[model samples]
Target: MDETRQWTAEAARAAAGKKGEETVVLDVGDLFGITDAFVITSASNVRLVRTIVEEVDRRVKAVGGPAPYRVEGTDDARWVLMDYGDFVVHVFLEEARRYYDLERLWADAPRLEWDEHDGRAVATRP
Candidate 1:
């Protein structure tokens, strides 16, 4: 796998650990082309959402993931988007996840699964 994908996955893991959720990493490289991946996960509440956003931001920066081009819906705390140039992260409350249906929006893109135990597993389409 490429280095950017590796960093993004690491960032996702950090966010999940901070927020305590089941996170899914999606490979959007085929669809968007610009972004290499999307890290999709749910937060139980506004506090969890904020935790995820902060965690992702801090870890990504620490690991040298490119700064997000933009972030949206942060103040509302329902849904927070951290748009790293090569990988966009969507941290959503359960309702927001269901309402936005981002999984369905990028349904065509392949799912990138990870090994929760090892923290090194990665998945992508050829």
Candidate 2:
């Protein structure tokens, strides 16, 4: 498994366990310079968003991953972003997710696949 994909998968699965919806892992390594991958997830409300973020953090840490370099939007409750250097995590509310439309903006970037049955994340294509 690619190390970065493993991080994103762990984050995605953690968020999903917390009831996060629309979870996606995008391979943005070739698209930009700031990060290699992105793990995006959405929740229904602010509280759920917070919960998802916390759960993701905990799960990632449980896997012996490095802590995020920076975390933002916990109080704002709009869109929380956790920067872990190699992979960035975004937990957003439904409206904010649609407004930002990251999936559309980064449409050119290939998506990483996550197998829920096995809990693995892999980059399958460009």
Candidate 3:
């Protein structure tokens, strides 16, 4: 996998390590020029949301991925956005995730499948 994809998978795994649910990676490079992909996941509560965000940052950095250029929504912890230039990590509370439905918003973008057991991108789902 490319560096961006590797970093995205690491972010997803980090979120999942914090028990983040419904983790998915969207290849939005074709549709969104600002970034190549999005790593999205949901947590059960505000605390979990924060935890997932922290874990994602730590793990990604540990793997030599660059720190997020900017992070937003930490104050609310409902939907934190971690912008890393090439990709962004979205950690949200269950309600916030369901409300925003980013998956539906970018439905046309192909889903990059990650191995649930290891958090490695295995294939792309059209």
Candidate 4:
């Protein structure tokens, strides 16, 4: 299995645990040398959004992935950002995600196709 794929899968699983919606993995390898992917998802409520953030943090640590460089938005939890060096995961309440619209902002980045066989995601240009 590929490292990128594994990373993406871990992200998806974490998002699912918190009932994340419209989860997307963006390949930003070409744009940012610091990270390979961006796993984005939104929850319906602030609590669920925070839960999604913690779940992603926990799962990534369980896999021995590097800890996030920083985390923000705990108090309100409308939008939580986890900044891991290779992959940044964003957990947000639905309305907040819509307001930020990261996917649309980074529309040029390639969307990853999940390989359900092994719970991995293969990068591909849109």
Candidate 5:
């Protein structure tokens, strides 16, 4: 995998380790120029949301991935957005994720197949 994809997988793994649900990586490079992909997941509550976010940051950095250019929505913990330039990590409360529906918004983008059991991007969607 390329560096950006490796970083994204690490972020997803970190979130999953914290019990983040429905984690998915979207290839947005063709549709969105600002970033290449998006790693999205949802937590049961505000605390879990924060935990997932922290873990993602820690694991990504531990793997030598760049720190997020900016992090938003910590105070609310409803929908946290961690912008890392090449990709963005979105950690959201279950309700917030449903309400915002990023998956549907970017339905055109191909979903990268990942191993929820091990948190690896196992294959690209055809």
Candidate 6:
């Protein structure tokens, strides 16, 4: 897998470990150059959103990744975003996920299949 997709899987696994639900990774490589992929996930509530966000941040750092270039929405924790140079991570509450509907917004982009096991992640394009 490419580096962008690999980091995306790692981020997704970390979010899943924190019980983040409806985890998804969207390949926006064709449409944008600022980043190669997006790792999106939903949490049941605000606290979980914070937890998932922190864990994902830590997981990426644990693997020697630089800190996020930018982050937003942590104050309310309703919808948090962490932007890594090659990929971005989004942790949101269910309602926010539904309302924003990023998956549908980028429906044309291919969805990447991913699985988390043994504290690691594996992924492939559909």
Prediction 1 global C-alpha lDDT: 0.78
Per-residue lDDT of 1-126 in model 1, one digit per residue for the tens? 476666677777877788746687888887887888888888898988988888888877776667788999988978788888878888889988899998889888778766544345467553
- Summed backbone clashes in each candidate are 0, 0, 0, 0, 0, 0
Worst lDDT run of 10 residues, candidate 1, spans 117-126
* All candidates: TM-score: 0.86, 0.94, 0.94, 0.88, 0.93, 0.90
User: In model 1, which regions exceed 4 Å deviation?
Assistant: 116-121, 124-126
Q: Which of candidates 1 and 2 is the stronger one according to TM-score?
A: 2
Per-residue C-alpha lDDT of model 6 across residues 1-126, encoded as one tens digit per residue: 365666788789899889999898888878777787889999999999999998998988887676999999999999999999888898999999999999888777777776675333343444
The alpha-carbon deviation from the true structure for residue 109 of candidate 3, after best TM-score superposition, in angstroms, is: 0.6
Candidate 5: clashing pairs of residues: none
Candidate 4 lDDT for residue 66: 68
The lDDT, on a scale of 0 to 1, for candidate 5 is 0.90
lDDT of 2: 0.89
lDDT of candidates 1 onward, in order: 0.78, 0.89, 0.90, 0.81, 0.90, 0.84
Q: Model 3, 74-115: lDDT tens per residue?
A: 999999999999999999899999999999999999888876
Model 2 lDDT per residue over 16-125, tens place: 88999989999898898889988999999999999999998998888878899999999988999999999999999999999999999988888899876555676766
- The model with the greater TM-score, 2 or 6, is 2
Please identify model 2 stretches exceeding 4 Å from their true place. 117-119
RMSD of 3: 1.4
Candidate 3 vs candidate 4, lDDT winner: 3
